[model samples]
Target: MFHTESDVVFVKGLTVEAVIGVYAWERAITQPLLIDIALETDISRAAISDNVNDALNYKAVCDDVSAWCQAIKAQLLEHLAGQIADKLLAKYSCHKITLSVAKPTASSKRIRLGCRSRVMQRSSKISQL
Candidate 1:
């Protein structure tokens, strides 16, 4: 039972360089990683007002993601993806979130390694504290 006005706002292909992974070589050097984020929320207020403030602050989301990514070192893309989703849920008012993390194929030894994570929750039920 979802409303038609419920939409997912997103920012994709946000590339940043960070020290990530378990390997010593990986820790010594930074690598370019890309992130895609989707946040689901009711956009009726924003639609009516046509105000950026009334909508999800996408620039703020990107800033938070960048800061979080730089602050932590994760051994796996799955962990990073989960962290991103959790941060979004905790920081913003949203019904659901989906995050994807991708690293270049040439950089990692693992075959086609990437991660995607999704979280769904009711906004009314979420506690602000």
Candidate 2:
């Protein structure tokens, strides 16, 4: 585990279309969603080497999540957020991951309906759930 202050790699304002929500109208059509993700990692090696392989691959993560969101039908923001968190935590070498999912069309202009989830890789615990 890295005891030093960790670095953060972020993907912001990612837009994707998905089937989500409980209302009849919502279920009938695919709606646009805005997603943000921050992944914690030790960037020391990547920074020094200037190597793409040594760093957290933010593009691949974004692409994977975008594709996944488009493929699944989720009823709530929580479930969608959880699925994204689970996928990233399983696929990446991140120490911690923060994911936010927003349904722009579901809410009024004044508000946004969404959910955020954070998953951490802990040394003391083997089970993530």
Candidate 3:
């Protein structure tokens, strides 16, 4: 049985190139996107048993997100972020997830603008991490 306690695993500053944009010129080529993800899970069993199966494999998650992002074209950051959340929620063992997708060069040369999306499965009650 899975534990009820919520533990968060995060990956930050993961930059990937994707075909995401609103303008025609922007969509002509790939742009850099910075993705941050937090997944809420119960890692007590993994911590105790020191088994990889008991915990989320962040590398696999990163690879999946990177591949998916590269393959999709989105006109809005919200849509892209939401897709990532949905994919992870369906594929991983986490009850809740928080994702931030940023286009570091979207608005201005120095300004980073994007969206954040969070999703939780209703079947599982998520605890504060």
Ten residues in a row with the worst lDDT in model 3?
120-129
Count of residue pairs whose backbone atoms collide, per candidate:
0, 0, 0
How far out, in Å, is residue 11 in model 2?
0.5
lDDT of 3 by residue, 30-96 (tens): 9999999999987888889888888789899999999989987888998888778988988998889
lDDT of 1 by residue, 1-129 (tens): 336666878999998777788788988887778888889888878888899889888889999998888777787887777777878888998888988888874345665457788887434544342
Local accuracy of candidate 2 as per-residue lDDT tens digits, 1-129 = 344687899999999988999888888999999999999978888888899989887789989998989777888898888878878888988889999999988757768878898888534443355
Q: Name the regions of candidate 3 deviating beyond 4 angstroms.
A: 1-5, 122-129
What is candidate 1's TM-score against the reference? 0.83
TM-score of 3: 0.87
TM-score of 2: 0.86
- Give the C-alpha lDDT of model 1: 0.80
Q: Quick one: best lDDT, which candidate?
A: 3
- Per-residue lDDT, model 1, residue 20, is 80
* Lowest lDDT block of 10, candidate 1: 120-129
**How high is the lDDT of residue 6 in model 1?**
60
- Local error of candidate 3 at 88, Å? 0.3
TM-score head-to-head 1 vs 2, winner: 2
As a whole number from 0 to 100, the lDDT of residue 119 in candidate 1 is: 84
